[model samples]
Target: MISIPICSKGCPTGMLSQFLLSRILENYPQVITNKNVFTLLQNEEFYFNCYQIASILKPVKELTNILEARNANLADCFIGLIKLGAKINQIQPGNQWKSIIIFNYNRRLGEFINNINILAYWLHPLYRGFGLKQIALNKIYETASILWHDLGNSEESCLNLLMEMRYWKRKVVPYDLSFNSIQETPMKWWLSINVQENETDQLQELALLLFSIVPSQAVCERNFSMLKWFLGERRTNLTLLKIESMAKIRSYYISNTDKEIHFRNKNLSEDELRKSIDKSVVTYDIFENEILERNENLEQENLNRSEENTEDENISSTILNINQFVNLTLPEFLSTGNNLFESITNRSNINERNERGNMEYNPISLAQRILNEENN
Candidate 1:
């Protein structure tokens, strides 16, 4: 006869079982008659080890939850990984599991950290290129320029984009405004820039494109899962058009209402139903274009990776510098009352700003004044 394991190892279930087993041994020793199980449950060291493992895994669990969220983006993923690494590094040196956890973490982190994530981290207004090395920053710029060219922009426009990025980094003129209102909304902040120059206009468009990208395929996977539910065995006869209409309506209703949609057999007017579907439906051409664009981006990314492999040393150095900078600055940044969740959760601070008002708040001048005060 095959034996079924009581609990799997290295999981939350195992941790819970360990805790409960300890309690069970204390309360009802007669329940667990097996001497081996009894001996294991009674061991205080086992419980301690379980607690240690749980504590080590907690930050990783939290990071997973954050990344799985709908609003989570590339910037969140980048920062989350950095923070996770930092938290793991803080584990007591004497802890037996510390070395094992660090080894696994570093291996996984190397796989996840790439140029796209680095670019997203640099672009986010909260950090604003704060912790990135010049080499890493240059790589991001090069990536952006390449993407710009691939999008059918002229050489002059690409150069202009590079120039505009410099102004943004240095907080010059229109870019130097107090952007507290839209600090969390990077796309909106980029859109809100009212520069008359064509060069800055390209920057705004590029920023929007970069920030609008979702970090993972979770949303797409979710949609497919929902579609599967909608097209169960009984509903297999439904036409493609009808299925598309139903999916769009269901998505719209759930997004706006945040409630379960119950479909009931009713005598609905065909005209009204058609109008609703038409409002939510996307054109087939648009879907095709999106697919093509994604394929092209994937191809470009593959090409970029092959080229980047030639300069692995520089890339490795850049990553090391980024980690060091994050370790040093993240605590100070958090101490200033700004945090990761604030950007995700807080939306009340977003305000409409006029061009004149935006131009009035010069962050560069403000920084100079602060420096002067400190020198005095």
Candidate 2:
């Protein structure tokens, strides 16, 4: 696959090509017997086509590899996609091969990449729609505005947030947008910039949200695999809480460097130690017992509360019935009887029946009435 781009040109511009030609000549002379066929292998145009294909696809392949990584999150791929798109756009025109390359490249891009992903790419600290044409920048800003508005912010507020972010990027950040060092991850980088200092709370929040999102489900799929391994045949009946705890513990150990200690243990083989430790770490009876105890306490509390509520309801019912009996008589004049009834109803603190399903124009009731008339 690595050799694909240089297939026609070969290493010395002739290495692999020469080897394949030699093999054909030695063992399959009849395959290329035609004069045209023989000349085609040596054709510069054919080699250039292969090179063009290779060059154009290389970045796409790299982006796929990055997204498929188990631990990779959105920030990595967002940066990568933006860079790849820029590189694709930079392909020189006026050349026939360049046009073909651009068209094929764009067609593939359109098939997979959508505006949402592009918006995410453009929002990155490294890009922030900088260096992009005004049209592209406006599109990115429009999409971002829609996203923020969808998340419950008003359109005006969303636009204001974008404007604030642009200001922060241009004026607040000490480093250039194209900073290549990138010593920290996107989240860490934004976090290091004190949220209170530059009034960057909103911008930092956006960056963290974007950074936390993953481009692919690879991390999720990997975690699922871990789940399967931990909850083997023996632990199939693990409760949701237990499973959650175990997963968190496993993930913590993995990220905290403690899990790597096993690798450094020379005396015990990894498999042998893992088998011995599995019972203690994986079974985790203490956590299960604590969780069970906590649940029991909560259930007891809920039962007591329900009993108290029932007693209160009994007292309230008695009081309500007596009050209703007293208020059932007609007014002396009968002129303001409606107001009297309203006062009595308002004074009673009873829960109302849900009337939503019994609307005046209920279709279900109308259908039932029609069916009854038909049957009659």
Q: For this target, which candidate reaches the highest TM-score against the unseen true structure?
A: 1
Which parts of model 1 are misplaced by more than 4 Å? 1-56, 179-183, 197-200, 217-219, 222-330, 333-338, 341-376
The C-alpha TM-scores of every prediction are 0.52, 0.45
Q: Best candidate per lDDT, number?
A: 1
lDDT of 2 by residue, 1-376 (tens): 1131254324434336555665676667777778887887766676655564555466666667767754455545534544454444444443355644444444354454554655554555544544444444445545555555445544344444565545664555432344322354445555555445524344455555655665577667878888877864343588889989988986676465445665545676656655666765665467776777788889999998986775554432211111111121223212221111100001112222222221223232332343344337
Mind giving the per-residue lDDT tens digits that candidate 1 earns over 1-376? Answer: 3222364443446535666666667877888799997887777776776676665566567667767766566777777766666555555565666666655565467677887777777777667766666556656766666666666666555566666777777887667655563454665566667877623466667766666665665878878877766753232488889988988977777465323434622354545654554555533466666777888899999988976664453422212323633553456333212255323432222222222222223333333343344337
- The models' CA-based lDDT, in order, is 0.60, 0.50
Clashing pairs in 1: none
lDDT of 2: 0.50
In model 1, the Cα lDDT at residue 80 comes to: 72
The deviation in Å at residue 123 for candidate 2 is 3.3
- Point out where model 2 deviates above 4 Å: 1-36, 71-104, 153-160, 173-182, 197-200, 219-376
